[model samples]
Target: MRSRSTLPCCITLLAFALPAQVINKPAQPNKFLEAVGRRAALLGREDGNFEAWVYPIKILRDFQLSVYIDNALEPTPLSGLAETVEVRPGHVTITHVTAAFTVRQTWVASLDKPAVEVLLDIDTSKPLKFRVSFIPEMKPMWPASFGGQSTGWNQKDGVLTFTEGMGRFRPVLGSPRFTRISEQIGHQLPDRTVMIEFEIDRSGRVPIVIAGSRSTYNEIIQDPDALVPAADTFYREFLNRTTSVQAAGLNPSYDWAKIAIEKGWACNDGVGCGLVAGWAPSGLSERPGFGWYFGGDTMMSAWAMQDYGDFAGARAALEFLLDRQRADGKVMHEWTQSSALLDWPKYPYGYYHADTTPLFLFTAARYVRQSGDRDFLQKHWAKLEQAYRFCLTMLDDDGLLSNQKGGAAAVETGALSGKVARDIYLQGVWLGGLAGFADLAGWRGNASLQSEAESRLARAREAIKPWFIQDKGIFAFAQLKDGSRYEANSGWQGFLIANGGIDRALAEKAAASLALPTLATPWGTRMFATDSPFYDPVGYNDGSVWPFVTAQTTLALFRHGQAAAGYRYIYGMAQATGLSGAGFISEYFSGDRFAEGPRAVPHQLFSSVALVHPLISGMLGLDGDAMAGRLTIHPQIPCSLGPVRFERYRVGDAWVSGAIRPAKPTSTVDIEVQGPTLKVVKQPAPCIDLQEVKPLTPGQRGQ
Candidate 1:
């Protein structure tokens, strides 16, 4: 049998060898035309921006478009005055209509280049001029700063080039039909913006190319008519590379989530390459909202990427983080795209999070399990050991992982006050990492290493009971520096259910607490129960409903055999996909209502996991041990989802095609496999074992 590591090469070879018709077709985006005011824009009118795939790409956050009649009138806002908008798979079209003329503009971020292309078609009786404008902010995203940044613009070779900060980023805007090119330089980068104009006649099409470099922009405008179709094809093929879910209400958002994940894969010139956390307009902030490489977010989002057939994407992300893993084994918390331009490491924010290390171990193990990449483990075994060893140094007196020693945790700045000695959330992740490390050790045939991990795993299991506030029927949110418990009904309980080795009864009890009004909301599970004194509906970690957190709780519920409850949360979070953006999910939402939180990102990379992970892992109950050539299919889907057909679901090197038909007592499951032979098991999904359910040690029982 071929190892999953070789699947990517084989798939690429097969793609070239096989006929095109046999390949899966990309999902067709529904044609949508709805009138929306400027406030209803996904990224907000003032802060909205678009980005394209470019090594040294321009951040199009403040970029705008307008039109002028006869080249004599004032440039009218076309985007802000948009009467209807149509968002397709890889492009967005905004339409503006008036008593005299109707204008439709389509924007596409070039799939293979660092250029953003726009196709403008006008239906005006009078001669019109279309304009593209933006102030070049030559600064990379936040946390990485460059001083003396100034904006300069020059027109040469019929293209207008905008330069920023010691000539680091130079972007050009040009069109074959350009009427005029102009710019205004400022003392600093913020005070300047550039404009490109195009002459338009009846139903005339103009292509405007904005690129990271002049040559690239010139090459694009030379054959501007071909950019949009090329971009559309690129996005389609990219989506077709992953699994497709044909469940009635689920496919749209599922496809959207796939796009969001694919878009998250970014590469900076000299900084590094990996999945970014999320992207929003930078606005007044130096950085776009979380628009940089994030180790923790990348690893967590990789779960969903692997769940679908994007194992290559998952592997790429894992390798990116592994390459940058700290010398002492702590995974990075954040890496700004402009790190190469600044003294990034000198800052303390990179390795500030304690949970990122364990998440690395967990995600590495998961990638190997799901992708059957034993060679990856063999190659990076020493680094994995270092990560696990680093985790051990953070243990508190009770044997649970301590946030104080490691770094910032889930509740970094809010919800919990004072120095936290330990938290059940971090401990649960630690338990999961320990289990994962043991698996890695066993895979490497290192019994001693596995034994050591197992030992700590057992000790942590015994120590966790003390944090269970028995009266509240909930796990303590944190153990402060004084070793006193801070009890609160929190969504973090789901972490224990999903990863911590809590007993089935205890997991069920904790999952039940999530059903209470204080913790459960119409949108999803709240970070903290509303009744808690510290709860804040919009607080970063206080009471917001993070879709990723909801995912943990949903999976926990399913792991504890609470499928109905899990489905409810899944359905609720899925609705946000339709609400916030066409197919995008926001970072978090208000715990008290269906609205997204004030600063929630329109498209968060990890937010997709809330749908993809649970829908595949929980509802479909598809777990893979690709290393063992085994896959377990234990569907716990509710009838409410109706019949579901999931195809091209990747399990290591193998592909799974499954159908779930609701029946009286249970759903009938039919699964078909391709690529490699697999031992398909039909049974209940696996859960964490509570250290053989043994009683606690005598010294610890009374605590």
Candidate 2:
């Protein structure tokens, strides 16, 4: 009944009296995070350090945008006190005033190229010595120097070049004549600093281009604005390909959704192009020196892209994996960009994760429903069959999918650390895959195959119930090889069952348990409960919160008659979307403070799509089955949202969009079909009897 920030009556009563001035004001609403350039994928700090990578290539490490005022040769990094504001797209003005002089630095990044532009505007009575520099980490790019090697760089032909065996980047300098030049070579930013001094000219505007490829370099040399359309063209292609959401002014989830999807896209120019897990083209990993392409990440994003009506993006991402599907139907976990290192011809696949295969099937079935791409379906049916067959092979003796024997799971850390046993979550996923596969078989008129998949689903449901749900608990996170249970708070629990099409008991139980703080955070759900022994808020899987997981759980909640709780998770995700990166939803947040953790990827697809998925499938509850030639709508909207609209949302060959709002005593949904209206099913929420249900912990049941 109150605002998101309102304190409970119990908490406010205990607050110590304070001066009127000490009272807190409603926090400033966080604005949308926008790209510096229309399609630029660069982020920075107050310090001069800038991270950039030419898409499809790895991160260009050690390069920075540094400025020196009044010949001091160094300027303090923007203190936390300094207010850095985006003055315009691709430009921000940073004014760090101190006793010495007040300096205004305008930072800019070219919308199309991997470049940073800056001009240090000074206001001082005395002769001011100002310099802007491009610093590079001294080590060569190739044979990556996790060794921390050092090398000095030089300028020739008006271009500053940094090269290593891996690749090369050249900065095309503009306008400013360097009065001084110097370089420091090593691992740290200071060690690799490059000082480029310039005289104060009539127009202080300076332009420099960081050329990633020979074509980009040549285009810039011929016409500095030549590559501008690259970004504009890319934006144009995806801008209209959208499914957006907004709760009036309350949330900016829709504002950041498109950006997050865009961030996940990268092209190699030739190998194959599709939506990636994250655009981690540059920047060393926490371990350093290696980069990878993730299959699980891609699969999750496929549904996200599909939700946005970008069937092409969704299809491309899925097809990319299907192309490399193992002979036995095992989808890969991850792969490197430079496949030469992995012997692509003989060993193109890297299968490790058990969920990827079943997930691939799940997504494949979804694509078929949304696209009615029977041609694509017929082509990949064998591979889909192989995927199903493979899932069966990996069914552990416990009648569940085991990550220890198959692949690294979504949970990468914790107390139930490692063993090749069934995780409660995988059973749900494998179940969903079986059901979906069976449905696909039925559509194809293959009774035998359909029956086979249906039988597997039947077996999975019976076996999974006892393994995961016990002691009147909603769900168990996982089972050890020796049959011991780790009844921890796992955010993925709802998703596992949701995907498997399981019953309402687990759903209702999860909802009741999560109403408290065990799994729920003000931001979203935690990977593991902070109170659990496996809890490590900052640990990758120990206790980090994942937006994508929250999105999946939100959908599960809505379907199982927990729409009230489901909406909270959805809104929490939307609120946290732009917190760290403005418009970008990051990879994961630390479990403790719900803050961004180390190596969290910004504009990550799954995270962005996580919000998108819940809004589409849960709130709108639109189901398009091209094969069945039917559109289903089961809307459950909270009255507080006022009125909501889903514009131009596509389902298979037919296009439909509509609006829904609270009616006299309930909610009413209206649909607009672009083409001839076909069979439409408007379903209502099922009755949920709460007469005997009582509050309970995640690990227990109560009446």
Question: Per-residue alpha-carbon lDDT of model 2 for 280-357, expressed as tens digits?
Answer: 324443211122456877877777677767777778878888877877778877655444333553542467677888
Candidate 1 structure quality by residue, lDDT tens digits, 29-101: 2211111110111133311234322333334445677777545567876654566566666666666676678
Residue pairs of candidate 1 with colliding backbone atoms: 49-61, 142-287
**Alpha-carbon TM-score of each model against the true structure:** 0.87, 0.80
Q: Pairing residues by index, what is the TM-score of model 2?
A: 0.80
Question: How many backbone clashes does every candidate have?
Answer: 2, 10
Clashing pairs in 2: 33-582, 33-583, 36-90, 59-281, 59-282, 59-283, 142-166, 352-407, 353-407, 537-591
Which runs of model 1 end up more than 4 angstroms from their true locations?
1-61, 69-73, 145-158, 181-196, 684-703
Could you tell me the lDDT of residue 374 within candidate 1? 82
lDDT for each of the candidates?
Answer: 0.70, 0.59
